[model samples]
Target: MEVEKARVLIVGAGGVGIMAAYALEVGGKAAVTLVMRSNYRRAQDAGISIDSVDHGKGIREWRPTEIRNTIPDVSQEGIPPFDFILVTTKNIPDVPPTVADLVAPAVSPGHTAIVLSQNGLNIERPLLARFPQNPILSSVSMISTTETSPAVVVHDFADAQKIGPFVPQPAAEAAARRYVAVYNGSGRLADVVYDADVPRARWHKLVYNASFNPVAAALRMDTARMRMSRHVVDDLVRPIMLEVVAAARAAGHVLPPDLPDALIRVDPVEAAFRPSMCQDADKGNLMEIETIVGEPLREGEARGVPMPTLRTVYGILKGLQLQTKVAKGLWEPAFDDDNPYR
Candidate 1:
């Protein structure tokens, strides 16, 4: 059977969402829409741009992109339903984090099977409960792209995707042609990884994210610096990666050997790259400390695995993130209402 063309709705016009839009626009992959909850005025100011900060390939070109939102606003009066929903928000959502709930009603089971492309786990469980019938695909994205504007998002690296049906969906040979279409159309990214064990890939990315982002955010250094510095890795990162690996094994996934070493060996081009955690901390926004760092530590304990290094990383990174949040006076957080804005 020929797959029906999908109407893509990308939530959160941050780096990932915008890049998804760029991918669609470049590929003309599917009819795409961009929905953002914050910095919306900016979206209105400058629309989607395809950007890559790897080596100054940053460029912003406005494609015919639709802008909707998760907050209640004047602009979101009547928008069409979506076939493919890409939720790019964080697993550790900011206060009043109800956008996911609100967006659920707008998606029908026939047209909606969301691809969770966030940095961590635990975001989909709650959504799964609410949308019990809708098939939620748990996905892992390994590319590291940076975005500050709607029209421009910088691609940091290229990695494949691992996607599988989660909760009430058939796990078979599925085609992600619509989702993969977007990345390939533009110079945004290359490669779509299907038919792989999603749990392993997700855990793999989680381990890598936990190891680098938190330490980088805490120390305000890029992954390259973290890899090259012996004191940093031996004393800090290596141990954390070990703990994360232990946790993944407990959860029935084992990363490849030499992963800790391989992750550290960065090319000179990427040596100075700041991770998303560091970027969020610097911007005074909430960080995914819990998802990226805490979940593995907790999972390890539940599965009788020892994760001393990860526990320490979680403690330090969570402390730093909270301290920053307190300093900015955005501390007393509230989960957002599930109200669709646009």
Candidate 2:
């Protein structure tokens, strides 16, 4: 008997989303449908072109089985309910459409598995609350990818994608493993691992993101400069990481004791990398401040864990974001008595 292929709906067309689409297509194990709101015409016309050191030298293109402009379009085009829905968009809480809203149209409450392939802490809370019966999985990736244009992506370095069940149900674990198998079967430079300790894995990745992303974005420098300054790494980076660990512990996730030191030992190659937050700052785009930093700070505050370092960094990033908005004429600076930073 022939096996039925999994139907996947990828909601974002950014670097991570395209990379996942490429892998699933190359694996030939799933029928992938990409929801590219801005790049639907480009992707439909020329497909997605990937230039990667891991995949080869030149530009290679791969088209998903279907490309739609919106989630409602998927059903309107006679597509069935997706077996798996992958959300690779930034987890910004202040954003107009929440992740739950974005994926709601395409998923069946109990039948579809939802995968969040974005950064940050407490990302699954709203999703779990909204879709109580669905298997919600979380993923953390070390890959460095950038979308240079509408249909073009560049993969700088490929790393393993760690996936795990957020709720840890048997069905969730099975779904996570199936997704892992699909990625591993692809000939791309993907090393997918199904992690049993999903929360721990998220906290482990947070150590690096919380430390480096905001610092780099605030200073408008690459990771190389941030890592090169011994004072910066020792004074700023280490403290921020320790605060994240503390917050994780306060939230009931006990990460490894040496996680801070492990995150501090940055690779020289990765030092030259520009994190997503830095890139967004460079382009004057909105950063994922709330999910990446603010949410964790709130967690710490609720648990009575003092996170002075994280709070300080969060304030700086928020200031930067406000300045950027003011510069772009999107915001006006007004004096408010309730503003603590004022």
Candidate 3:
């Protein structure tokens, strides 16, 4: 008898999600299904095309074992439960249909592991609160892929990921190990690794996400343009990164003191790469300001650590979000007669 393959469902079909599905398919260890929201029609009709550096250039018109548009469709009666449900969507809790709601139906208590492959800090809180009995695997990815258009992906660089149990319970740890094995069984396309301390890993990634990501959006510049200016590095980027280190230390996740400098040294100085938030702002989409900046800032303040740089950037990004809302006609500005400026 043929052994049964592990079933996996990916919630977001962006560049990261597509690459993840590709990795799983290449391994042939599991049956992969992708939930495409924005490009469902295109993906269902034309399939996904990948221009990859790691998987080579011949991955045109690729589809996972299943293509789904909603979680409910996959959670229907008689279908086998997913062994893993990876949420690769951008972490914008401010938006409707919280990630908790989006992935709740497919969760199989004590069976399915919830994997988060997105950015930001404290992103697993809601999932933990909702599924106290299930395992929540937090991950930090180092892939460089982009969705230039609908159903099209450009995989330029590394496809690595480090995942760990969020709650660290026995069940959660086992889930993390299993996921690492499944993800890397096909020669480690995602280069999966297990991290015992995912929180510390989150803080390390935030040193860049909290600093360069927001700054890129606020300044309307890419990574190369921002790195071009010595003043920007010395004044804004370095300061914010240092503040993040301090904040992380205050939150009991002490990162390496040289982390900021090391990250700067390895940053692609010449690539005109746009971080996720920069791309969101350019498209007038909601950014993960609260999770990336607000949550850490609050964590610091609760511990009496001052984060003026983060606070200032948070305020600016909030204003930018408001601008986006107004442009989309989802929000209206109000004038108060008591205020002279109004």
Candidate 4:
């Protein structure tokens, strides 16, 4: 008897999505299908170019087990039910067609496992609310990879995936373990640990993400420049991170006292690194403000914690996002309150 491979559908073909697809395909235990939209033609015609530090160098034109321009509907011919649906897109909740809607067509109730490999805080709530029976694996990815261009990915720094179940039921735990096993089969990844407390892991990671990502975008600075700016790091970044720490603690996820310092002091190798939010801002795309900064702030405030610094940053990013949306014509500007146009 021959063993069957796990059929996996990756919904987003961004940097983290492509990286996940590559790792799964290279692992050889699963068949990975990547859904590409914008770069679909580029990926099909030229193939995805990988310049990865972990998976070795000079590997050009890499394709997954399968690539579809759109998410595969279960009714589609020759498309098998996917065991895992990985969503690696940015967690921008203000946008329409929520992530739940994007992956709902292919989701097999109580069977298809959902994995969120994106950024932000408290991101699992919407999915859990929509797909009540399915296993939700909330993952915090600690990798410095970027889609430099269409169909091109550059992974320079560490790559680690800390995932766990949202509810921690038997099915959820099993899904978490199986996903870890499949991902670990690659044997090249630095770390792919199954976290017992995924929410805590999320809060801990947010200490770095909620601080550096938006601040970097706001200042238009890379990791090196942010570090070089004594006032910026000391005054703005450090205080924001402390606020996150307080919020996490308020929410019952007690993080280490020195964790902020640990993340603030990045390795010299990752000096030129820019966060995803910064990249999004640079490309004139909508920044992920609400989920990354808003949700946690709300959670903290509800619990009587004051996040003054984080609140200020969130307000600034929200204003910037408003301007970006108006420029893109996704939103209309309302200047005068009494104007009919407003």
- The TM-score obtained by model 1 is 0.81
Q: Against the correct fold, how does model 4 do in TM-score?
A: 0.94
Cα lDDT of model 4 by residue, 1-342, tens digit: 656888899998888888888888888888998999888899999899998878876778889888998777886655568899999887788988789998998898878999998777767889999999899998888877778888899988657989889887999999999998888778777588888798888888788888998998898888777888788889888998998899899889999888988989864635587877898899899988888889888988899898998899999999899989989998886677778865
165-235: candidate 1 lDDT, tens digit per residue: 55433522243434555445554454555534666776787766888788888888877776667788788
Scored by lDDT, model 3 comes in at 0.86
lDDT of 2 by residue, 119-202 (tens): 888899999999998999998888878788888889887746889999878999999999888765565544778888887787
Candidate 2: Cα lDDT at 65 = 84
lDDT of 3 by residue, 1-342 (tens): 766778999999999999999988887788898899889999999889998887888688899999988785445655778899998988888767899998888988768899999777788899999988789998899888988899899999878888999887889999899888888767846467999899888888999999988988898788777777877778788889988899889878978878888876666766787778999999888888989988888887788887888889899999998898789887789887787886
* C-alpha lDDT of candidate 2 relative to the true structure: 0.83
Better of 1 and 4 by TM-score: 4
TM-score of each: 0.81, 0.89, 0.93, 0.94
Q: What 10-residue stretch in candidate 3 is worst by lDDT? A: 70-79
- Model 2: weakest 10-residue lDDT segment is 72-81
Model 3: colliding residue pairs? none
Model 2 error, position 310 (Å): 0.8
Better of 2 and 4 by TM-score: 4
Question: For model 1, what is the alpha-carbon lDDT of residue 265?
Answer: 67
The C-alpha lDDT values of all candidates are 0.67, 0.83, 0.86, 0.86
